[model samples]
Target: MPRQSAGILLYRKTNNELEVLLVHPGGPFFVKKDLGSWTIPKGEYDDSEEALAAAQREFEEEIGSPVTGTFLPLGTIRQKGGKVIQAWAVEGDLDADAIVSNTFELAWPPKSGKVETYPEVDKAVWFSVAEAKTRINEKQAELIDRLVALVV
Candidate 1:
C-alpha cells in the first residue's frame, strides 16, 4: 500500500472571498521553487495512527500555531504517484507573517556524515482559492477544488 498522510485545509471567508492557508517546504530543496511547490500542512503516519489527530498535530507542528474551529471531512485523494492523502477542512483565519516552524534532523548535503536540522516548513501564507490553485501542486490542488465544491 502507498504511504498515507493526513492534513488540514485551513480556510476563511473575508471580504466576500475565500482564502486557504498553504505552507512552503523548508531546507535546501525548495528554497528556489515557486508556483506549484506549496502544500497543505501534512505529515505521514502509520495505519495505527488516526487521521484527524494526525492532521491536527501536523497543523500545530508545521505552523507553530494552535488550531481552532471544527473540522469538516474532505475525504481522501491519491496523487498520480500513489501517495494517499486525507484532509479535513476548517473555517478559520490565521496570520501569515507570524509563522513559526518545527525542525527535524536530517543528513544535510546527502551523505555528509554530518547531521543537521531543518525546519519542516519554513513559512505559511493565506491565498485566495484562485491563487492557491496555481501555487499548490497540481495533484494536491484537487483537494482545494473538491473542498470548495462541497462547501460552496
Candidate 2:
C-alpha cells in the first residue's frame, strides 16, 4: 500500500488578497533548498486514524498552534514519491515568524555515525496565491489552486 499523509493549508486574507502559509523543512538536506521545496505542514497517518484528525494534529505539531474552523476538503494528490497526501483548506491566520516546529534526530553527513537534532520545519511564511504556486512543491501546488477555487 502507498503511504498516506494528511495536512492543512491555512490561509487568510490581507488587503483583499488571498494568502496561504507554507513551511520549509529543516535539517542539512533541505538547508539550501528554496523554490519548489516548500509545503503545507503535514505528516503521515494510518488507516486507524481519521484523515482530518491527523491533519489537525500535524498542523499543530508543525506550526505550534491549534487550528479551528470549518475544514473545507481540498481533496488529495500523489506526490512524486507516490505518497498520497490528503489535504484541506481552512480560513485562518498564523504568525509565520513566531512558529515553533517539533524536532527530529538524523545522522549527519550520511555515514558519520553522528546524530543531530533539527526542527521538522525551520521556517514558515505567508505567500500570495501566485507566489505560493512558485514556492510550493510541484505536486502540492494543486492544493493552492483548489483552495482558491473553494474560497474565491
Who wins the TM-score comparison?
A: 2
Pairs with steric clashes in candidate 2: none
TM-score of each: 0.93, 0.98
Mind giving the per-residue lDDT tens digits that candidate 2 earns over 1-152? 99999999999999999999999999999999999999999999999999999999999999999999999999999999999999998999878999999999999989999999999999999999999999999999999999998889
The segments of candidate 2 whose C-alpha lies over 4 angstroms from its true place after superposition are none
After superposing candidate 1, which stretches have Cα over 4 Å from the reference? none
| Alpha-carbon local distance difference test for all models | 0.89, 0.96
lDDT top scorer:
2
Clashing pairs in 1: none
